[model samples]
Target: MDTLITLIRWSIATYCLYFLLNNYISYFYGISLNDYYQWFMLPSKQAEIEKLPLIFSMILFLLSVVFLNLLLSSIQLKAFGNFETYIYLGNSSLYDAHYIKDGDSKVIVSQTATITYNSSFKNIGLTQNFVSNSSVTDGLGKPQSAISMGNLFASLVITFFFFIPMLGPVHALLSPMLAETYTAKGLNVFKYQWNDSFNALLALKGFSLAKWALSWVAILVLMIYCTFRFPLQQFGKRAMNLPSYIAANQLIEAVPVSIKPIYIERARKPGETQYFKRIETSRRNVTFRFDKDFAQSVYVTAIVDTENNNLIEDKITSHINSHGKMQLKITDDLGIQLVKY
Candidate 1:
C-alpha cells in the first residue's frame, strides 16, 4: 500500500510539473491551440468533441487537485494519523483539573462542570479519568488505493456532469478577447522590438522554436475572438446608438444652434487650421465649432447689451481650448462640450 501510494504521489507530481512546463513553454510567445480553437473554431463548432481541449483542461485540473489532496492525506497520515477526532470540552476546569489526572490520560469521565472566574466556579468533581489516544485510525475506513480511486471517479463524474456544460460559454464568451489582446501584444512586441531577447533566453531544440511560436499565435487569436464577441462588438453597437439616446433625453423646445461661416484650411504641420467668423449676438448663450481641424486658438465672445453700447466679453473657458476635437454646448449659464483629444 505504501509503495503504491508513493508511486501515485510521484506520478501526480510529475503530471503537474509537465503540465506547468507545457503551459509555460507553449505561451512563451503568448499564443496556443487552445487560443486558436477558442477564438476561431469553438464559436462555430456545434459539437462537444470539437471543444474537448478546454473541457479536458478543466477536468485535468480538477483531477490534479483531487490527486494532490490524496497525496497530502497520505503524507499527513504518515506524520499524524489516518483518522483523527477530538472530544471538545465546554470548560477547561472539568477537563484539566479532575477528569484528566496526568500523564498518559486516555479518556475523560465528567458530568459537565461550569467554570466562571468572574461570577462563581462550580465543580461537579467529575468522577472518571480523561484519556487521550495517539493510535492512528483510517478515517475513510479503507485502503489508500480504494480512497484514491473513489475520489478520482467522483471527480470525473463531477467534471462530466457539472463542468462540461459551462465550458462553451466560457470559451465562446471570454477566450476571444484574451486571444486578440495577446496576439496584438505579441505582434507589437516584434514591431517595437520589445522583449527582443525572448528568443535568445530559450534554448530551442529541433522543431520546438516553430512549435512554440505557433502555439503563442494560437492562444492570442483565441483571446481576441473571445473579447470581440463579449465586449468589442457590443461596445461598437452601443457607441453607435448613443446619439439617439442623447437626442431622446432632450426637451423638444430646445432650439437648434448653428455654427456659421465654417471654413477649413490645411496648416503647414500635420493638423490643419480652421477659420470661422464668430456670430456676434446679444444672447448670453451660443455654441461654435469648426468643420476642419484647428491649428491655432479660436475665440468666442458674448456681446451683452449695456446702457447704450454692446459690451463684448470672452465667453470661452480654459476647458474648451485644451482639446484637439470639441463640441461646445452653451446653456444659459453653463458651458459644456463633448470633447475628444
Candidate 2:
C-alpha cells in the first residue's frame, strides 16, 4: 500500500535526521550533546542547556526544526496533508503548490494562464521569547494558554533539556506541554521577576517534590484540554449560546465574519524566525483565554458568503457573564489584555 510505504520511508528518513542532529544540534549552542541528552532530554536537566546565551539557545532551537524539514526532502518524502502525517514520518513536502483549473473555465484557461501568490510565515519562530500582553487561564483560575511557534517544537526543545526522566515513547507523549509553557509564558521571567535562564537552570536542581508533581499535572491537564477538541467554527455551538442563532440548516449565518487574534500564527521566511502556519482544513480547536484579570473580550468570525471579511474594523461587539458575581467585558474585534492582580 502507498500509505504503508510512505510510512516506512518516512521513518527511515526521520531516524537519519535524529541520528545526525541528536549528535550535533547542541554543538551549535556550544554545549555537549551527551550532557544535554542525559541531563535535560533524559531528566529535564534543571535548565542546564539554558547556560548557552538566550539568543544562541533559541537559534539552535530554530535550526533544529529548519534542518528537520530540510532533511525530509533528502528522503524523497513529501507531506501531503496535515503535519501529523509527515512530521512523525519524516517529510519535506509540507510546502506545495498546485494549478487547479475549474472544469468550466477552459474558455480562459490555456497554457499561458498563470497565477501567483506572495506570502510570509512566522508560525515557526520560537515564541517562548515573544513578549506579549495576552494571557489564558485554566479551570483552576490558572492561565495556561497563549500563542507559540508550536507545541511540538516547544516540547522537543523541552524534552531535550527539562522533561522528567522518561523513555523515548513517554517523552513523545509529554513533549508538547513542555514546549507550550515556555512559548506561552516565556515572558514570565520578566512578568514575574524570576531569575535569569542560567540561575533558573541552577536552581532547578533543588526543585521541590511538589514542583515535580505540579509539572506532571500541568502536562496531563494540557493533554486533557485538547482531548475533546473541536475546530474554531462559526456555525457550531460557541460564544456561549451561539447555537441559538443557527437557522433551520443548523448553521450560523452571517453577512460578515472576523475573528480576533487570528491565532494560527504568521508565515515566515528562513533566517527570519518562522512558525508553522495552519493550512485550511475542516478540523480546528478554539481555546478561550483571559487576556487580563477577566475575560475582557471575545473575538467572533463568521463567513456568511464569499466577498466579505471584516475583522480589523469594528462592526460588531459582545460580552460574557457567569455566576452573577462577575461579568467579563469583550470587544467584538480584539483580544483580552494582560494585567496584574
Candidate 3:
C-alpha cells in the first residue's frame, strides 16, 4: 500500500512539471493561450478544425523538446551501467514452506525472499555464485526524461487519439501504478535501500489523476469546436457538386424509347408468388436497334427492383461502341423487374 502511494506521487510530480513547462512557460513562444485552452478545456468547433494546423505545429515542437530530454537522460543512465533486477521462483519453492532470516541467526515471522545469482564462470557444467550490485541511483531522472519525451509524442498522438482516445490519460495513470507494483515486489526479493524512499514518495497519487482528468476535459472542448465551425459550403462546392456544363446537356440527350412491359411467367414454388431477385441474374443482355434519324447520343440507365418493391439495382452508366450509340448491360435475379427514373 505504501509503495503504491509512493509511485503515484512520483508520477504525478513528474507529470505536473512537464505540464507546467509545456503549457504555462511555453505560452510565450507564439502559441495562443486561448487556443490551448480550447484544445484542452472546450468542446470542438467544426468550423475551426482546419485551424488545428497551428496547434499541431506547436505540439510537435513541445514533443521534440521532450524527446531530447529523454534521449540525453537515457544515455546518461546507460553510461553508468545501472540496471534493475527481479526474481522469479520455481513452482515448488513459490508454493512450499519458507523462512525469513536477517544477518546472523535472527528470524522474523514475515514473508521474505531468498536472493541468489547465476555463476560468473562455469566449469564443465559446474557453477559458482556471485551477486551483482549495479543500481539505478537517479530514479527521478529516468521518469523526468520520459515525461519530457511524452510531451512531444503527445502532439503527434493528437489526431490518432480519436481512435484510442483514452490512451494518454490511461498511460499517465498507469505509470505510478506500475512503478508501485514493481517496487513492492522488489523489496521482498532484495535489500534495495531506495525502495523504501521510492515507495514513500509514491503515496501521493491524487495529482496524477488530476492531470489525466484535466487533459480529457481539454480534448472534449476541441472536438466540440471542430463540429460547430466546419466549412461545409467550401467542401460541397468543390467535392460534391455536379458540373453545370454536364448537367445542362447530359440529361436531355438521354431518354427511354420503345418501353416494353415485362411480365412474371410463373412462381418458382407454391405460395411463392414472387421470385427473389439476385445480384447476378437481374440484367439479361440488352439488344439495341439504332435510328440514324436521331443525331444525339443517348445515355441509357437500367434500374431493377425486387418483388418487395425495394430497389435492388439502379446503375446510371453508359458505354459507347464504334457505332457511337450508348449500350448498357445489367444482370440480376428473376425476381427483379425494371423501373424508370
Global lDDT of each candidate: 0.33, 0.28, 0.30
Query: Candidate 1 versus the native: TM-score?
Result: 0.21
Where is model 1 more than 4 Å wrong at Cα? 1-50, 82-178, 186-341
List candidate 3 segments past 4 Å from native.
1-157, 160-211, 227-341
Evaluated against the true structure, the overall lDDT of model 3 is 0.30
Tens digits of per-residue lDDT for model 1, 1-341 = 65676577667655664455346535443445465456455544334333555566555556555545554544444444442222221122222211232232343433322221111111121122111114323111222322233443443343233222333333333343443564565633222221232332233223333454565465455545533432210000110111221222232111112222222343354453444434444333223322222221112222223223232212123323442333433333322332211
Q: Which stretches of model 2 miss by more than 4 angstroms? A: 22-35, 41-341
- Write down the lDDT that model 2 would get: 0.28
Which of the two, 1 or 2, has more TM-score? 1
lDDT by residue (tens digit), candidate 2, 135-230: 212111101121122433333333333223221222222233333444475523222212233234224455443564566667655544433342
Candidate 1 residue 245 C-alpha distance from true site, Å: 99
Ranking by TM-score: 3, 1, 2
Better of 1 and 3 by lDDT: 1
Predicted model with the maximum lDDT = 1
